[model samples]
Target: MKYQFFWITVLLIFSLSACKSIQEKANDQFLSGQYQYAINSYSQILENEPDNLEANQAVAESYRLSNRVEQAGPYYEKLVEEEPTFENVYRLGLSLKAQQKPAEAKAAFEKAKGYTQNETYLAETQRQIEAINLSEGIEDYFPNYELVNYTELNTAGADYAPVISENFMYFTSGRRASGIYPADGSPYTKLFRTRAEGLRVDVGNIQTLPEFQNEEGLNQAAIAISPDGNTIIYARGNSTSPKDLPETALFASYFRGAGFTQPIWLPVNEDETWWNSTPAFSPDGEELYFASNRPGGFGGIDLYKATKLANGDFGNAVNLGPNVNTPGNELFPRMTADGKFFFSSDGHPGYGKLDLFVAEKGADGNQVIKNLGENFNSPSDDFGIFFSNYPKEGFISSNREGGAGDDDIYFFEDKTPKPKIVNVLLNVFTKQRVAGEPDAVLEQARVVLYDSSNDQEGGDFSNSNGRVRFTLEPNADFTIIASKGGYFSKSIPYTTRGKTPNPEDLIQEVTNITLDTTIVLDQLILDKSIVLENIYYDLDKADIRPDAAVELDKLVQILKDNPSIKIELSSHTDDRSSDEYNQDLSQRRAQSAVDYIVSQGISADRLVAKGYGESQLIIENATTEEEHQTNRRTEFKVIEIQE
Candidate 1:
């Protein structure tokens, strides 16, 4: 009998120890923000002791934090059903409201009224019911999005960045269509064109750009077309060179009025190093904008711009500055015919991952960017958005739930009211060196402008001049190109001032651009290279000031005319700071120029950005501010031939 009693005692001790261990774990998890785990533990205890009010209540609280209000509703209802107390009834009603069952929720609130007669909870519940009723009457401003894959087109590896133009849709995918390099030896992302047709559902018939294929790995995305559908600009990375990842740049090809022209790399100054991406053209095709991670931006990636000049050259680039850029990555910008800018971002607070945002030119011409709201966004990643100016239909790429693949393209329609017209100016120019003059004469060249930024054809060049001028609707960005034999072909950097057109300014003002003559081997051999003496920056700040904009803009024009040119962005800093910091600072400064060019619609791939920091100081042991400024300078170098 004593032995039996000893065994019973031992069993009792063990059971108590297990219970303590479970409770301790539950408490620890609860305090550590592991509410789901805590709820599971508490549930185990409640299963053994159904009437354990504390364990039951803990489960309810956990459910609330986890956004599982429907699960919490039953537990609270049971507590009220058994006790019929004012507190229990009120809690039950609250849970029902949270679950969004307004009619049933109201019934629970009415029951609570019988117990408490509290006017505040009664009024709040009544208000909630009314709000729900109101919300039901209004259509969800944001449409539900789902990604559908064209399995007939996509292969085993990757697919993304879809763009629609006229009857055809173009996208960058990793399919092994003819001319595509294999995944193992030569990895590349190529531009695939497809004809998409349908109303409620559309099917895309895919075809690869055979003529533009390169042996290098291609990371292509963010495509744009000219208004006449004769030119195309797309982003590309070095896929053929595996060691060269994240070195993606932008490239352009003419549609030949029949098929695509041979693809060519845009040029940059020799000193800078950075990757460019996401080319968007204004309606007139005079300006281009793209994103880059080069230095001098407010943060990671910033937008920049370049212009087409009279000499059939692209002028220098300008940074878009803080108004349109932030510390986080700003990418995939699309312009509407009305001059509104659309892009995806994670820096701004919204529903989740990367939310779609619209920025319009404010009355003062500054960009005012705003979130589209919760109905259009979720906790998952949303990106690569495009919109049509006509039917107003749009598509976005996302990895959210209900996608056909890893990243599916979602089609959506905008129900929001059409934006009002704001008149803006579109300009194009070219440069030609006068026979006897040292300066190049900026004159009208044959300019073709397209509104690929907003996925709409705005206007075409029926006129000849280095300059093509037109009234741009507000909320639009455009791409402008100029071509003449013997003179290099040039493209305008993408730009959007986002301003309401002042008729007064439009009446007399003209957006002027000057392209320069192509530097033949003879002329280039004479000078070889030119040093940019004025690419300056302030103390400790990488922000590109207006003065720097003037010079960089000039360099961009030079590249535009000579499509075969490739350049590098380089930075040098004084020896005052730590080498690492100086290197970083110099890199930032160099990137600032690259950012400016990209915002102008120069592709990131054309430019390579590097920072020598104090290592390449021009003025060693300089003590003066001017000397330090000399040391802390930025420069560019030509890298490759685009021809």
Candidate 2:
């Protein structure tokens, strides 16, 4: 019995000493930020003592920090099952949740509540339940589209920005075959075209543009095609030519039967100085909208528009206004088939980096822009949105995981409900009375209406008589503002709500308004900036009401005398809704305004419609109705005047 006791003591001492050595090693590794190594050490200890709670928990924690949720699940489950402690179970639930097993996570959290009797843990479990509920209906947002095929084109270092037309797919690539050497003699990025055969899903017969090849340091991106696909406009960066600096000017070239014609630069008038690129053409091919970083703009890069005169010259570029251009960078403007605008932005709050967005005209002619949410966007960069109207197919490029390459092209069919039409009319009033005319008749007096809900959507002007009318979609609200060159701007508020229909229904109405001429005349004489009342909108809608029309008529008059004047119609809205909803509504509102003007005899080609949505809200917060109202509005600025 004495000998047996002596052997047992020795064995006990060796076992305890081994554990201490292992623990010390793990502590050193964990404190040094060697998480993986620490995990290995803790795992070794847990193997010796299966119920070593501390060691098991540490293993789970290290796995989580490494973003290896799948690897941590078993250990967390074991820790929680063996000891139903609040900390153990709570952490175990988190691990399950990270692995996307919300049901199992909720169950684990519920079990934990019994162990600690802590209200905080119970409350957290309820929150998790709510989040799971919200995620339940999420699958509907992802449409069912067949992945035709995934083909490895060339072993290009970085290939992206694939845009498809009738028979060709245009893209930018940094590949050795591009023949464009980088500044350091490496492969530089260049534009390439390939035949897109019957949607085979593989790039075929890739060819490079000779004119854009082998440049030392120039980078070209964001290409836009004309409606007829005869002209191409793209952004060229790092240009040595001084003329290219001031106006990120867009160049144009006709398509000869054989190939593209020599490129010619299109410069904006000297008055509007800025860096402009990423040109998007209207369906009629008479207007061009592009991104610019210019002074007097809201901030960052804003979208601007210019019209092509009968003489084949583009008029001066006009800023899209505060609604569409925010302090954030708004880029990749593309016009949809129904005349709405779409783009991408990082400034707007979204699921992640540079999600896709849409802007539309509201009944009051304002731009309302919004972000497309999680179903389409991920934590990675989601951008380069393009859609084909007839077949109703589109493509988006993303750098998210589980893609074919670093950046993969995702094809989708728009399954979300379409926008509804909501319309409003307004009567204009001015302080100065015209001789032999009623107070309403301000000849050529401009009235501007903004869809306060979605700024990127609604933007319009009045006719010869100070009267304006526009349309908007349902599920939105707006603010109205009216202004003349020598008159103060006037404002009003409105709202709309209802379940959106399959194809949104259109609503119409009218309101009468009067402007204070004293404020306008005084500010003009003093050369002080006239402060226009801010407009507002609901979560995602861009419809205008009678109140919005009053402001739109003021803008109409501004365009009449400046017959040489060309302006960009911009819309904006608040940030309370899903990005896709806001984008679609904003776009509809913008198109609604352009439609109204064309009906009133403004050349259909003269006015341009652009939507920035919530990406360009004037007010940062929407805590109050007033602040929300400030975010929704529409406005216009002169881009050019033909002498």
Candidate 3:
């Protein structure tokens, strides 16, 4: 439900004329969020008193509130050019930003900065500039992700705020229900759900969640379920009644064996205030994060987290502080498993209305906030993101373009390269040498991944499905090694080298790739040669560059893992240089790599360096630079293995 209140300065059109009743009615309409009606009334007053300051301002504000931002641009432009008040220039900047003319909006903010003596206004203008820069550079925020509309779950009314539990996808909707909300004439919002197939939900089989519909006429929305899927907390708002007074509160329900228990008032809600709603629980169930317009907030609606006491009640709600909450409404706080905090805010520089943002502490322990970018956001509201598991695949709610109704749900996955990852699945198997023989699943196999670039190692055992899962970083080369007691160990290397964002995508989003790979293991054999690719040195130089170090580190790790194996480290050069010079340079390159591996704690006695100098060329008579580059290589062969 849309709350009725002025986000900007409230206007009171005081006139000493007989038409004061008309002006009062217009002010009442604007305050009640009836912007179109307010526009008509204000325009009638402006026809007679064209120069009336109150009437002109009210008309401009109405045009803005009704999402007709372009219509309000001229009035603000005129107002600022005449007497540039902070409110006029700031609102003008917003109008320009809404119209996609961010350059003009930035300029308007600059002008507003000069006109205001208040520090809050100055800081807000700077934030608007930051928002414009972020808007222009969206790929930086979200790198490699695709968003798909939840066509199955959406209706012709409003369908949003999807939460996943077991096989069901729970959400809130205002479709053709039994009763209509007097405030908006839409059907009263109710809890609904359907079957979930991974990220794709089965919309053809939608049904209402029967437990919470006992209330005759109320709007239900913004639900959060515990990780264990036992308890549910949702927002319930009554229809606009003289007794209800447009108030909303959070309610908690326990999941019984068959159905949900009777919902009762959540302890953190305040009865006097009408703005409390949209409750979310932390993953650990230790804290509750909720939105409220209670007194002493930054402004509008601010997010507050309450501690769950030992007595099963909540303690005093604490504001999330300026780090998360802003003067604009900060609603829908969802915490990921990795401690990332996701929320929606209009106060931040956004596309328009409300935009989804994620915040987390970086390695340096400072809070890092970023928008989800244009793919997940639009000119309207986008909030209520549900992660199946953080940094993997999940769903989000949006009232963006080309939707089935006012608000629709969308699914998104992480596509960017990172050091830490989530939701990566691998299938482990072993192949027999006999032709046409099917590979057998390698259950109970030990799978270990060594990140050569970062020197991190993680291991997991293959399950009954021959599946092993892991979270990985995207910025490194990984050596995936799999082994079982009776089978020979095999190793394969994978790199994220070519998975970087395109130049245009740099400002838009990070790329997330969902991988389902089969790792084939061969029986162990002696005298096997493992060639390391992309370990090239500069012409006439034996020093390693950053890229070469990444590959060389893999060799270092291989030597460290098979500590009892003595190996020969060899280097080959293209035939361009003279044999003496090439041999000498190649020897130095081999020695240099051996020394580097020894620096990483590999035993020096177990290694030998040799210069092949094109003697063992894989491609003889190579004419192209590509072929010549391939001839310049490095390899390590196991000469001896101690039992």
Model 1, 109-217: lDDT tens digits are 6677777667865665454445445434433334443334344544444465677667677777656633343222223466777666421324444677553663343
Candidate 3: where is the Cα deviation over 4 Å? 1-25, 31-56, 59-84, 140-142, 177-188, 214-218, 256-258, 413-643
Q: How well is each residue in 95-197 modelled by candidate 3, as lDDT tens digits?
A: 8887778789889899888887898879878987887786766653556777888786677887888888887888888875667654334577888878886
Off-target runs (Cα >4 Å) in candidate 2 are 1-156, 177-187, 210-216, 239-249, 256-259, 269-274, 361-367, 389-391, 403-407, 414-643
For model 2, what is the alpha-carbon lDDT of residue 81? 79
TM-score of 1: 0.39
Assess every candidate by TM-score.
0.39, 0.40, 0.60
Write down the lDDT that model 2 would get: 0.61
Superposing every Cα of model 2 onto the true structure, what RMSD results?
Answer: 27.9
Higher-scoring candidate on lDDT, 1 or 2: 1
lDDT of 2 by residue, 1-643 (tens): 9999999999999999988989998877666445677887887987778788788877777776544555678887887678767877776766666555767877877777787756755766665555545544433223544322133553324455667766677776666443332122224466777777434454546777553343434556667777788888776554434444533455666777888776666665233355667777877888887877767776667878889888766677788776666555677777776767777765554443455766777788877665655667665567776664433566677766666555566666645454343333334333444336544444444445456543644444555644555454445665555556654344555444442342322342322222222111111222221222433344445555455555555555545434555666776667888677777777777777666666566786668777767887777867998787677666665444445
Least accurate 10 contiguous residues by lDDT in model 3: 1-10
